[model samples]
Target: MTEDRKKGNSSKWRPQTMMVRGGLTRSEHGETSEALFLNSGFVYDSPEEQSARMAGDKPGYIYSRYANPTVRMFEERLAQIEGAEDCRATASGMAAIHTMLVAPIKPGDRIIAQRQLFSSCLWILKNLMPKMGVEVTWLDGSDLGQWEDATRKPCRFALIETPSNPLLDAVDIRAVADLVHNAGGELIVDNVFASPILQRPIELGADWVVYSTTKHMDGQGRTLGGAILGKTSKIVDELQQYYRHTGPSMSPFNAWVVLKGLETMDLRVRRMSDNARVIADRLATNPKIKAVRYPGRSDHPHHNTHASQMPEGGGSMLAFSLKGGGDAAFAMLNRLGLIDISNNLGDAKSLITHPATTTHRTLTEHERAAIGLDDTWVRLSVGLEDPEDVAEDVEQALAGR
Candidate 1:
């Protein structure tokens, strides 16, 4: 480990310690694993106690929609892992994104966001926000100048996704946060790519951090969930109203699954990131590969920034373009036997997807091209497989193509 990494707060204990024991809450039984509460609402022992709980005079869960022990355990554990003052779990990542964005801005407000995003996220910003009377401006996310320019205008919110989907683009979270703060706006970072294991946007000065727990947190394809973390004031007082009333709360069973997923997340992410580094290096030397983008690799545009921001490594995700285009990509995908042809990331098994037709299909051809998602672009989510096998499978697939 680097000297800086060896001496930080997290340096004292390895990531595994943080992942397993960071936010454990045991009941009187002292169970080894986090408990699951499946009930929709908690019953009171007495009418007076129930009234007091309802009036916020006592501290206990009144309804599952508002809170549950399992959901609270997941939230608390994630908050501790993220080093945030508060957190709330949503039914899915998009639900977390929607609640965070829609809850804060009023009609006639303005939001500045990065242009490259998940297709669903792009639709939320470009299509949904305008309809709600919130004007939005799209800027090249990596361009600090464009961020400054956009923030200088009257903006209430800013949305960014570091190591963006499909393209693996990155933005300086601290610099952008500074600019957003100077212009009187809150910066929300979608940290799904880096996962909490690789990046902590709140420590970088972002006002809020969101995650698609469906990805790395689960480290498997078993469940779908999302979370938002920030200071206690906005999370409890402001964001809670929108989250609870919208009824997008995470199910207790899903929360229990995610809770278990967290125990080994750090290990899974580390191994996956290592695999990504190896694959990225091998892919870069291939003649059929047009370009490769992995934050861990030095060839990436923001390698230095990613190095400073992500202490563990770039992450388990990377994207590359083929020399022969979309047809070539399909041929390679068809021949691949080890890696699954799926868009989901942060799984125990390797997966691949073509962004042009799958994730970014919502965009027009011109818009998709503008974001560097060409027909040949293939996104790979490295898993806990042997690096040699992964590399050989990719090479064999490309050869058949």
Candidate 2:
């Protein structure tokens, strides 16, 4: 282990400073940028040294599947910014979610989650967990009564994503964390929407926090990555074994790319969030739009909760419903010239997607309707583009409708 990792000096610095210089360790050659240790394995000075490392008597890299210097730098930098004691990087956001849920659970354990989740997450809880003999329960995330009632019985774990996907519904993290803990369950918060720059779930009492670093962390629609953050014991002891054996490891190159991306994440997220607020406000007034959902907006159903938890900004995402349903939604999307029609979000370019068709297409109409996803609803991931330009493009599209 490097002294830099041990000391974690970045923790004392502010978030922007940490992103730029945190977890920085230089090789003997003293490179300015973080070195990418691309090799699959490392060498030991002697067989005795290798034995000690394998036996846990000494700390050093063994295999890329387990750890690498470049990946560790990324993990440490993110952990510092998140205020987590430790962090582990994975191949993708889904991989991080899978590891966090699967590592500390066993067959027949009970898991409770909010119903409004990303499509892949819904699949895992609804389909995969049951096949693994894990009991899963779903509830409306914004309803505290539902959370309190369901957690009355003991459970192994509980998970929720605040400002939920597509809808931007907010949940009380502190309240949920208390309920889950009282029921002998650990709380795992998916903080992708409210990035570390916006919200820190650990400070709100969540036991574990996970992110698809592919989103705001990369902030450029480049390289895929995910991360899990929590106490050192939980990661090094409970989750590390499963992570190593399953080989859902992040590539050194991707880690390095994201490490560089972190340097500008704070600036990009703030600017993008400002742009989203401007666009969402404009959408709210348009007669053609039925509703606009932005956590920063006062009319949002959970605006108070969002204000309390993420006062920094409402986040760079917004969703609105058009009066014309799917056809009108598609027409507006086709008419927009400046924004790209891509499902991917948190990019430098504004992108939009129809949740009912693109992201949640697999779900039955009944299932989609239950979560407030309709053909007319469109989710927009505001990017670091000029707010006026994005608004102009949207206005022209809506004018045609």
Best candidate per TM-score, number?
Answer: 2
Off by over 4 Å in 2: 1-10
lDDT of 2 by residue, 1-401 (tens): 65655444544577788988888877888787788888889999999999999888999988899899999999988888889999999999999999998887889899999988888988889888998899998899999999999999999989899889989999999999999999999999999988998988999999999989899988888899999999998888789999999998999989999999888999999999999999999889999999999999999999999999999899999999999888999999999999999888888899999999888887899888888888999999999889989988988998994
Regions more than 4 Å wrong, model 1: 1-15
The clash number for model 2 is 0
Report the C-alpha lDDT of model 1 over 1-401, residue by residue, as the tens digit: 45433222243455566566555556777677777889998889999999999999999999998899888878877887888888999999999999999887799988888888888999898889989999998989999989878887777889999889978888999999999888888999999999888998998999999999999998889999999999999887778788878888899999999988998888899899999999999999988899999998888988888899997798999999999999999998999989999989989999999989898888998898778778899999999999889989999999984
TM-score of each: 0.95, 0.97
| Candidate 2 structure lDDT | 0.90
Candidate number achieving the greatest lDDT relative to the actual structure: 2
Steric clashes per prediction: 0, 0
- Scanning candidate 2 in windows of ten residues, the lowest lDDT window is 3-12
